[model samples]
Target: MTAPHDVPDLTGSGEYLVPDVLQPGLTLVLVGTAPSGISARARAYYANPENKFWRTLHAVGLTPRQLVPQEYATLPQYGLGLTDVAKRHSGVDAALPGEAWRPDELRRKVEHYRPRIVAFTSKRGASETLGVPTGKLPYGPQPQPLDWPAETELWVLPSTSPLGHNHFRLEPWQALGDRVRELRGAAEAGNPSPETPVL
Candidate 1:
């Protein structure tokens, strides 16, 4: 697979199932385990109709209006971004190869972009990225990993995938959205954003 000419190979591996929609100064970056088959085929994040990601973003006030998958590239204007752990693969979590979950590369991206908050859309992605067992990870804010930028925060949200319906919850996502809005409000007010909690 060849990297899209328009999207720089941020990681330099030269390919992505779905090009990352990311840039510096984003308020939030939604990290997923990988694109679903439908999304990879569409070359857009959360393209699957059954996925609740797009709706959830609007429901939580992260996006002013509901956006279809095709509008993913426009998220940065709303202070949001998107990427996945398994960039070279696309499928359900179980089918992904071990090598595809590149936590180090994700860490590198986070260190460089320094988004105010990084939220994993599923426990599995959070676990793989943080090296913590999924059973130990709670929803919502997470402890900042060592060596991460001081101004950056981390969060874990329930997966919006229909396959994860049994465990899906909106409260955590709502909390994150609320925090994102708070930060934006503070920045717009020319006030120092609230301190990131130690937890």
Candidate 2:
């Protein structure tokens, strides 16, 4: 969703964050907690130099080469998209106010786009949207929950933030790439609804 009408458009004024990269038939959509302060200023997702999101995506073969955050607009060319549960906010999770989160809006976007997969870039984001405790959510493909559309799969990936240093691992991301590849193959074979293996 674009910023509310009342809120000034940051992109056009060179002061707002980059608009979300989303559309139908996307192979994957990466949802983060919110844009970091650096990202907001730079108008890019995962813009912080310390954030490993872009590197991880390249390492996992999701991108042809490592992309700088500034190149986020090119994500859809690779069948990928970017968004967040908190659209109008930009900061660390702890600093965000209660109104920052809009899970219902996220659900609406996901359902409307019907991407093949919706992967949360952090457990905190997944938990907030799924209404489950972070401790209960595992890293990788989630079971087909009632709240999500059956055509769209859900995944919880480790956060690439510097703050998540203790929990950072590239294995789960590589696994996500594999799943996307599998899904793409299935779709090419006229089996777009192949059941995703729960992880």
Candidate 3:
């Protein structure tokens, strides 16, 4: 069946937050496949009460130790920017069937933003987007670099969402935060990463 081409109502969905561009000091551009209802309503990424994104990022040190969702906008100040492949929201990613996978858009963003690292927040998103078999993927660092423009680095991160948990726990997220801070620091130094990093 041809799905209806209707824009989902975001009036109460969490807000969609995209920085004017990407933050300059970004060694990491945290890109999700899209937003969910809670995040749309909260106007923040992973705003669902159970979603552990900010908590994980903070735990990892990518964010400045804050617990409130409203503070999410400030992540760019720390050299992290937020975005998504699909701007619309569905309660679950599986519901977003046939959502166009635009690697070109991703590539364009990489070229434009020039972040040191581009991390995909969910393995499902990365797997679906890149067409990699689920079994062959690695933990933490990806086997190969991201195929984005301008030679951006890529890393596949374990998703912080409760639903996205393939395995592991909060400890790994803390490590991600530290990695983000390190890359942000590196980008600030002008020695950008050689590969497109996705998490």
Candidate 4:
């Protein structure tokens, strides 16, 4: 299926495969490499039925309940947000064009929104953003990149995409959920949470 031409990119870069669901002051923001063909056609993040993204959010306690991809716009109410490194592309990672991955754009968004935590749904996205080789990127929290805001934390999670079955592991996702809850709790109590250690 082709990406819908009617959707406009607010950033003026071009048409977005799936409009980003984001806002300032979110507790967490999940970043992906790009929308899959199915997601682009649906104009929703992780719209494929086989994709575990939505279910994992609830299973890991990031959301109160499992959310359909169509309900993505409501994530801010739950202190969650979403975006992709390749806004104009829609396909599997291997098929994406080199120019489509704009790590700087993602950095600007994260710096502006100031979410408490930013987790990459796949190592490829994180690797591109951090300029590290995928083989060197480990799961869970990572060291702060140079010039990254100290208040915001970075994490790497296994891809929820069906194609990522070989690399998928529930443990890292669970750890991320637990850490998000901790940060939320600390914020609710008006206490400063300690920095999350790299896992």
Candidate 5:
């Protein structure tokens, strides 16, 4: 197997990061607040082996195949895109210490990309980045979708953080996966897909 890469420091860096392996007009875009320990080392957001991302997508039918860590960037081929709320890496999400992600940049991404869905990997990302209240924000299109938003669906599911509710990733994953299914349908129909996975 190939080795993972290390995360670059967030301090004093200037870059307008877009979703990893995002295809123009992709169906869904997965977001995180920033890189995690595993992702930082792997140089791919959500590259952690323990992360249920691919398995959940497979279960929900977004991906017709399985993927190892290095293949994460290839997710867009299966109609998925990866990105972070904050483009920097701070080893752990908790290490973020505060609102490390910028809402303006995220809004800009949404407006520019106009992805069908925007899903946050964790509630922290949604709360810290998106204007959502924390803790289990639900499993469908947000009740109050943004007007200045990218016309993409927004959602805030449970945190995929290893430090989060360690035992219940699958349940939330399944629910989120179901939502993804709906978004994919919209994408296939050329309608506004209403689901975006956020970190």
Candidate 6:
């Protein structure tokens, strides 16, 4: 794992707009379908100012303060990280080729990193990873771990994209923060938080 102060190389194929910000021991990892066109050009995740990813993180108390998209690399310090299902491409989910959704790659990363929680920023991401239709995914913790290791949990959150504005709700994000806090509290108390919800 890269040290917190060391800049980890996130670069990949030319198709990759922005490199993935990932490492081991993350408390949470947010997966998206792909980068927005603007984000691709800007070399940042959720670079569009309109995207709610950064704002929601702060609002949910997941971060100490609101962070701009350019600050993504600093996430690991707070036990948070970012990645996408389609690392070799950038565009809206509907425009991407079916093969672009590489769930196995995501699984390998999660298994290697072993984060406490893995949350999909959009149902499409979760569906692609879990091999289920988006309609079947509910917002918040998922009961099944899919192919994830038993030590990790899964969560599905509504898309923060402007296109998903109709379904946007902050409740699930807040719940996620609460669960993280619960896990931290349990760990600090030297008790196992086995039943902590993935939400």
TM-score of each: 0.92, 0.90, 0.74, 0.92, 0.74, 0.90
* Candidate 3 worst ten-residue window by lDDT: 1-10
Candidate 6 per-residue lDDT over residues 52-81, each given as its tens digit: 999999999899999999999899888888
Clashes by residue pair, model 4: none
Candidate 4's residue-wise lDDT over 1-199, tens digit each?
1123322353333577787777668989999999999988988889999999999999999899999999998999999989999998889999898999988777777766688899999999998889999999899999888868788999999999999988899999999998988988888899988679656
lDDT of 5 at 7: 26
1 versus 3: better lDDT goes to: 1
Candidates' RMSD to native? 4.0, 3.6, 6.7, 5.4, 7.4, 3.9
The all-Cα superposition gives candidate 2 an RMSD in Å to the true structure of 3.6
lDDT of candidate model 1 versus the reference:
0.88
Which has the better TM-score: candidate 1, or candidate 2? 1
The 0-to-1 C-alpha lDDT of every candidate, in the order given, reads 0.88, 0.85, 0.61, 0.86, 0.63, 0.83
- Residue 82, model 2, lDDT: 90
Worst 10 residues of 1 by lDDT: 1-10
| lDDT per residue (tens digit) for residues 9-68 in model 3 | 222234433322254446677878776777766666677777777777766667668556
**What lDDT, from 0 to 1, does candidate 3 have?**
0.61
Q: Candidate 1, after superposition: displacement of residue 153 in Å?
A: 0.3
- Number of backbone collisions per candidate: 0, 1, 30, 0, 18, 0
**In model 5, where do residues sit more than 4 Å from their true spots?**
1-19, 97-99, 145-147, 165-169, 186-199
* Clashing residue pairs for model 2: 10-16
- lDDT by residue for model 2 over 38-85, one digit each (tens)? 998888889889999999999999999999999998999999999888
